[model samples]
Target: MEQNPPKSIASIKEKLKKSREREEECATNLQLLRQDLIKARTAAIDVVMAHQKAVVKLDEELEENAKDLKNVHVHFLSEREALLSSFVGSLLRKEKATGKTPPQPDAPRFVAPLHTPTILCFLRTHLGKPGMLYCGRKVLECEDFMLKTNRERMELLFAQHRCFGCFLPLSVAGHLKLSDCPHPRYCAICDSKDHHQILCAARRVYQGVIPE
Candidate 1:
């Protein structure tokens, strides 16, 4: 076999130099990649911190708004009570001065074309409460008998287009007399469209219809 050419010192030295240069370049690239990774990590941490801060601020604002709404509602109730008291007091004084009975304001009138069985059920459920059936009735009275009697009477009144609360005849109308009420029915005592259970306790107390 032919002998291989003797290895040259120059070529070997050149190969060694190229390998060393490649190693240096790889090391430099790795260092640059590590720096970029550290920067990305820092940026992610900052974003998370900012998001947490925003959430905390939003919660605080919501809490403050809720407190404001509660305060406003309480203020409104106080004002409404004061106005009602003033109106009642003025009416009483006017009656005393004139020495004539004040004309009772006509109850709100509405035309309820539909029979509300739900209202009857509600009245039966919440018996003996003010502005509800059995308000003045004794518990000893037969519950079934009373409900049966009232149910028949109410059905008759509904057919006759009469007010459920006062049994007064109602004027034919397509809508509620009270602007706030959605139902086409009215309660003189409760002055609400929801139910005409019995005489309203609040009205009785305010108008001096019942002794405090």
Candidate 2:
């Protein structure tokens, strides 16, 4: 309490310099850590973007593959139908009574496949050959409604029996004094198994009941 020690300026200056050096070092370390954190965040973003791009590419490839598969399926079905149609056409050609030979497949330009049904005429009957089915005859004459069939389809004609009365010719449906006579009922003409010959105009003419 009685005596005071002399202070040294050199020692105090040395302590101040050491404290400043420590604070600078801490600042540098913080800056390095911030840069590292930024680099890590950028890397993570790049990885996520890359993953998204790969997923999009895979989805596009899968879609293309699915379309290819569908096309293959359609082609397979088309080929199958063509094969069956060809088989049916071959059988019908063998049924022809003509001495003339069938047109060879390798002959020339194949209009359609060999097995496609067409309407081929042997004689007066236009029923044979390949073509569309006829449900009933109509009096209206048109190119579209005509029997534009092919020869291989002849077998399909007369496949089932219709009433003999209803089976009259198309032109006759309008000209004749006919009505749709129901089967198995008391009709004066179709009383027997054979065609109802009783409705013959000649019979009425002979009996003097009506004009011939």
Whole-model lDDT for model 2 versus the true structure? 0.42
**How many Å off is the CA of 24 in candidate 2?**
1.6
- Each model's lDDT: 0.50, 0.42
Cα lDDT tens digits, model 1, 1-212, are 23333356667778999999999999999999999999999999999999999999999999999767755654454345446555666776888899998676586221222323223332343455766555343322333323232234445445556454333445643432334334444344333465442322232122322211
> Per-residue lDDT tens digits of candidate 2, residues 1-212?
33333245667778889989998998999999999999999999999999999999999999999767755654454345446556655554665555556556665322232122122322223343366444332312222222222211111222222222443332533433324533321223223332222122222122332222
Local lDDT at 107 for model 1: 62
TM-score of 1: 0.43
Name the runs in model 1 displaced over 4 angstroms: 1-7, 100-212
Error of 1 at 71 (Å): 1.4
Q: Among all windows of ten consecutive residues in candidate 1, which has the lowest summed lDDT? A: 203-212
